[model samples]
Target: MSSPFSNTVYVWQALFLREALDRFFGSRAAWAWLLVEPAMHIGFIGGVWGMMRRNSMGGINIQLWIIVGMLAFFLFRRTAVQTLHALDCNKAFFAFRQVRPFDVALVRASVEAFSMFFISLFILGAAAMMGLDVLPDDSLKVLLALSGLWLFGLGYGLVTSVCMRMVPDSGHIFQILMMPLYLISGTIMPLRYIPLPYRDWLLWNPLAHGLELVRLGFFSNYHTLTVSFSYLYYWALGSIALGLALYRGLETRLVTQ
Candidate 1:
C-alpha cells in the first residue's frame, strides 16, 4: 500500500508538471510571448529613461539597473498573481481526494518562479549583447534579495487569495493595489528621486526595501535607504503563516468556492 507521504510526493510531482505545461505551452507560442512581454517592457522603459541621458545609476549602467530592478519586481508580482488564482484554475483537479487547494497554490507559485528565472536570464543575456553590464557584483546578495522578494510575494498571494476566495469582489481591490504598488516600489522610478520624509515613509514599504536591496546587490557602489532582510521576511513569514492557517481552517471552502 502507498504511504501518505508517497502519495503526496506523487501528487506534487503531477501538479508541477501540469502547471508547468499549462504555463509554458498552453497558448500558441505561449513560451515566446512570456519572453517577449517583459523584454518589450524593459526595453521601452530603459529607452525612455535613456533619453533623459542618465547613463549610470549609483555607478552602474542605468539600463542594466532598470532591467534587473524590473526583473526582481516582476518576479514578486508574477508569483503573487499566479498563486492568487491557482485555486480557481485548478478546481477541476480537486475531484482527486489527494489534491488540495494549498497543493495547487504551491505548484502555481513554483511555476511562476521557474518562469521568471528564465525570462530574466534571457533578457539579461540580450542586454549583455547590447553592451550593458549584466553581471552582479555580489551574486549571493542578489540571490538572497531575489529569494526574499519571491517569498514575500508568494505569502502575499496566499493571504490575499483567501480574501479573494471568500469574497470574489475583494479581488478587484487587490488588483487595483498593484498599480500604486508598482509606482511606489521604485521599479520604474528611483526612490531617491522622491523627496525626504516621504521617501523615509516609503522605506516602510517592504517592496521598496526589497527593491533597494536588489540594486545594492547588483552594484557595489549603489546606495539607497538602509534595508533589512529581517523586515522583509517578517512580512513574508507572517503572511505565509496566516495564509496557511486560513487554508487549514477553510480547505473545504477553498476547493468548493
Candidate 2:
C-alpha cells in the first residue's frame, strides 16, 4: 500500500548504502578487483571468440560488441551472484536492533547494484580510451534500457536473496547454469549466426531479450529482436512477491539458522 521510496524505505536504503560503501571503500583492492575481473572475463572469453571470427565475421567488430554486452551482463551477474547470499553476507548487520532481514538484503543488493553501475561507466570509458567505440548510437534509448536492466537486477536480487535462504544450493546451481546462458543467449555471438534450434530455445530466457535490446543500441543496423517486456516484468514481479512473502514468513527461521 505504501510507496517503495517512502521515508522509511528511503532512509533505510540510504543508511544501508552508506554503511556498505564504507565497507566497500575500506577494501580498495576489492573495488579494483571488480574492474580487473571483468577485463579478464572479457579478455579471455570475448577475445578468443573475436579472434576466431576475425576472418569471416560481418558487421560490427566482435570485440566492441562484446565489451558492451559484457558490461550489461556483468552488472546483472554480479548483483544476482551476491544477492544469493544476501542474508548470510550481512548477518552481522542483522544482529543490530534496527536491521530487519529484508533491510539486510535490500542494503546488500543496493550496494552491489550501485557499485556495478559505476563499473559499467568505468568500463565504457576504459574501452573508449583503448580504441573501442562504447558510445551509444542513441543515448536516451540506451539510458532507458539500462534503467530497465537495473530494475530487473534489483528485483532479481531481492528474489534470489530470499530464495537462497530456503534452498541453500540455489547459488551453486545458478553458477553452474549461468555459463551456458552466455553462450546460448548471444552475448558472445550474434543471434542470427546461432543455429535455428538453439536460437529458438533461447527465446525462453527473458534476460536474453533484455541483453539483445541493449545490444541493438550498439549495433545500429541490426533490427532489434522482439522481446517480451511483460515476460521480464513477470519475473521481476514474481521475484518481488515471492521474496517478500518468504522473507516475512520465515525471517525468524533464517536468521536463527
Candidate 3:
C-alpha cells in the first residue's frame, strides 16, 4: 500500500491548487484590484507622508520604505481579514461532501496570501529597476522574515476561521483589532523612532517583531531591529495550536451550517 501521508498530501495539494485556480478566475476583477489597490494606496500614503516629513523620516527615502513596509503588512492583514470570513463566504463549497470547512478557509487564505507574496516580489523587482533601495542586505534574514510572516498569517488565519465560525460576531472583533495593528506593527514608521514605553509596548505585537526583522534584512545600512528567533517560533506555535483546537471543536457544526 502507498504511504498514507503521501496519499493525503497528494489530495490536499490537488484540492489546494484547484480551489486556488477557481478563486483566481472566479473574480478576475478582484484579482486586478489586489494589484492596483495596493499600488495606489502605497503611492498615495507614501507620497503624502514623504512630502510632509522630508526632513527627518530617515534619509533612506520615505516612499521606498513605505512600499516595503506596506507591501509586507498588507500580506498579513489581508490574509487574516479574509480568513475571518472564509467559512461564511464559502458555505456552498462546504456543502459538498469532499470539501471541509477548514479546507475552504485554508485554500482560500493560502491562494490569496501566495498571490500577494508574488505581487510583493514583483513590486520589489520594479523598485530595483527604478533605483529604489529595496534590496535586502541579508538575504537569509529576509527569507526568515517572509517565512515568519506567512506562518503567522496561516496560523492566525486558522484561528480566525474557527473563531468566526463559533461566534458570528467575531467578524467585528477582528475589524477592531485590525485597525490598531497597523500602527503598532511599525508599518508606517520604524520601531527605533518610537519612545521607550511605547517601543516596549509595540514589541509585544507579533507583527511588529516580524516587520522589524524584515526591515533589518532589507536596510542593513541603518536602523537596528533585534528579534528573537524563539519569540517568532513561539508565536507561530501558539497561533497554530489555538487555531487547530478551535477548528476541531467547531468543525462539525460549521460544516452543517
Candidate 4:
C-alpha cells in the first residue's frame, strides 16, 4: 500500500496532467490553432527571406534554417508564456491542499513542451515536402540543444510567473522585452552572419547560444564554435534556483492572493 504522502503526490500529478490535456485539447479547434499559429508565422518569415535570398544563407538552406530556429525559439517562448500565466489561471485549484502553484506551472510547461515537439516534427515534415532538407547532421546534439532550451524556458517561466504574481503589470513588460530578443537571438539569421562586436554581445543571450547549437546540429556544413552549453546550463540552473527560492518563501502569500 502507498503511504499517504505518496498517494497525494500521485493524485496531484494525475490532476495536473488531466488539466493540461484538457486545456490543450479541450476543443477541436484548440489543437488546430496551436499548430496553425506557428505554421503561419514560419511560413511568412521563411517566404519573405527565401524570396530575398535565392542562395543559402551561410550555406544553410534559408527555409529549413529559419523553420528550425523559429521552432526552437518558440519552444522556449511558448513554454514561458504558458507558465507565466499558469498560477493565475489555475488559482481556484489551489483550494485543493495538494494542488500547489508550482504543480500548475509544471503542468503548463509539460503541455507546451509536448505541443512544441509535435509542432516541430510537423514543420520538418512540411519543409521536406517543400524540397527543403530537414535531416539533422547530429540528431543527438539537436535533442540535447532542444532539451537545454526547454529547461531554460521552464526556469525562466518559473521566475517570471512569480514576478507576474507579485506585480501583474510586469507581464506586459516582459512580453515587450521578449520581442527584441527574437531578432537578436538568431531566430531569423545565423550567428555567423553577424560581425564580431555585435555577435559577441548577442552571444550573451543564452537563447542565442541555444539557437546556434540547434543550428549546428541541423546544418552539416554549419560550424558553431562560440556556443557553450555550459553557459546555457548555468543560466537555467540559476534561474530555477532563484525561482524556487522565491516560490518557497512566498508560497502562502502567493496562494492566498
- Top candidate when judged by TM-score against the true structure: 1
Quote the lDDT for 12 in model 2.
81
Candidate 4, residues 1-257: lDDT per residue as tens digits?
Answer: 88978966786678667866786779978878888988888889878886886557667777777788889999989888888888888888899887777787778888888888888888789788978779898999899899889888888989998999999999998788778988999987777678988888888899998988888888868756478888988998888888888889999988998
Q: Is candidate 2 or 3 superior in TM-score?
A: 3
Backbone clashes for every candidate come to 0, 0, 0, 0
Q: What lDDT tens digits, residue by residue, belong to model 2 across residues 1-257?
A: 76745756765876676656764676858678877888888788666886676622336666777777777777667666666667777676666555677776666667766787787888778878988777778776566555566666666767666667778888677677668866776677666666778777777876677677676766676544566556666766677678788788988877877
Scored by lDDT, model 2 comes in at 0.69
Alpha carbon RMSD to native, model 1:
1.2
Model 3: how far residue 257 lies from native, Å: 3.0
Candidate 2, backbone clash total? 0
Model 1: lDDT of residue 112: 89
Cα shift from native, residue 257, model 4 (Å): 0.8
Ranking by lDDT: 1, 4, 3, 2
Better by TM-score, candidate 4 or 1: 1
Candidate 3, residues 129-225, lDDT tens digits: the string is 9877676789898788767776777778788777777788887887788778887788877787888887887888888888767766777764555
What order do candidates take by TM-score, descending?
A: 1, 4, 3, 2
Off by over 4 Å in 3: 1-7, 53-59, 95-98
Per-residue lDDT over 71-123 for candidate 1, one digit per residue giving the tens place of the 0 to 100 score: 98888888988888888798899999999888989888888889999898888
Evaluated at residue 80, the lDDT of candidate 3 is 77
- TM-score of every model? 0.96, 0.83, 0.87, 0.93
lDDT of 3 at 21: 69
Best by lDDT: 1
